[model samples]
Target: MNDNNKDDKTLNHSRRQFFKISTALTAVALTPSYILKAADDNMDDKIAELFEKRDLNIEVNGIVHTLSIEPRVTLLDLLREQLKLTGSKKGCDHGQCGACTVHVNGQRVLSCLSLAIMQDGKKITTIEGLAKGDELHPMQAAFIKHDGFQCGYCTPGQIMSAVACVREGHANNEDEIRSYMAGNICRCGAYPNIVDAITEVKQKGGTI
Candidate 1:
């Protein structure tokens, strides 16, 4: 009777182990597809977010452009990277050197510090746009005449600020031009020539 009892107990334990193994195998086989589907869904969402772009419509150099840009992109990057307008140099990206200066709605601004999204429906003027088909703007002509640049890396920003200085009526004299154009740093020490360019433009009433 005791032997019969022991055999029955062993049979029950074997059945339990078999059922547990079968359940685990079923779960393992079925869970992979579900887990893979979940991972695929997550990857799709991440790809969509990574490629998200905002529509941008702004006039550049008298021509209007419709662009798709990321929110974190700066105007400088949009101009240089997307639009192929590289006249504006990326110097002192911190907005301290003023090398990324450009005109927004006729007001000089630091493009490196300005976001492209915020400039929708605005007029932007870079150094490339400062000239017509074959004629240069008065400011450009004056800079050339006065030899306002040395290495020319900072010339674009210097010219833009100089134009603004004249338009704002801040180019009355040497001191005023220096004070107003202080934001632009010409490492070549072309301060005197820059002042000369601005003063000439002011005296001649140069067209901005």
Candidate 2:
């Protein structure tokens, strides 16, 4: 080939390579900035809005706690996230599952469905508050003795419901107990032991 033709081809190739490198470097430099901006936007949206944070005063496990909480925060989230009492599980945040069940003013309530603001001035009792100084309640002891749980994910709710069931006179018989506890589904299929635990607690005149 002629020298001039060869030189022209080399120049074109060099220009192509330079353009490719420049494009790639521009993309790489812009990627992190775009990602950072998206992350910042997400953080801003997640920041609890000023007006949403409202003052909350409630008695939890016999202790009165006062703090500001988001209006959208559920009672379960308030206990687990704000107060750091994680004994209540977050199964089925829509209240279909009873893992988040707790006692509100001595009544069994689905914490996941109840709002923190709605529970103001109410007494809240979680699994952590069920026992008294190394002494398990009769229902808890009965559950342990009867082996009422396998994975134990739903045990807290089951126990809590059992206590309330007895208190509400719903534990008249095995069928009654089972029917009343139907709301708290135990995935482990420990229904028999759960009934036995409830029966034992009832026989002992135990009240939660």
Q: Which candidate number would show the highest TM-score if scored against the true structure?
A: 1
Which ranges of candidate 1 are over 4 A from the true structure?
1-51
The pairs that clash in candidate 1 are none
Report how far off residue 28 is in candidate 1 (Å).
25
| Tens digit per residue, CA lDDT, model 2, 12-89 | 556545544354354345555654454445532222132235667899999999776668889999999989998888
Candidate No. with top lDDT: 1
- lDDT against true structure, model 1: 0.84
Candidate 2 structure, TM-score to reference: 0.75
Question: What is candidate 1's lDDT per residue for 127-200, written digit by digit as tens?
Answer: 99988889998989988998998899999999888888898999999998999999999999999998988888
Misplaced by over 4 Å in model 2 are 1-50
Question: CA lDDT of 37 in candidate 1?
Answer: 60
RMSD of each: 20.2, 18.8
Question: Model 1 misses residue 116 by how many Å?
Answer: 0.4
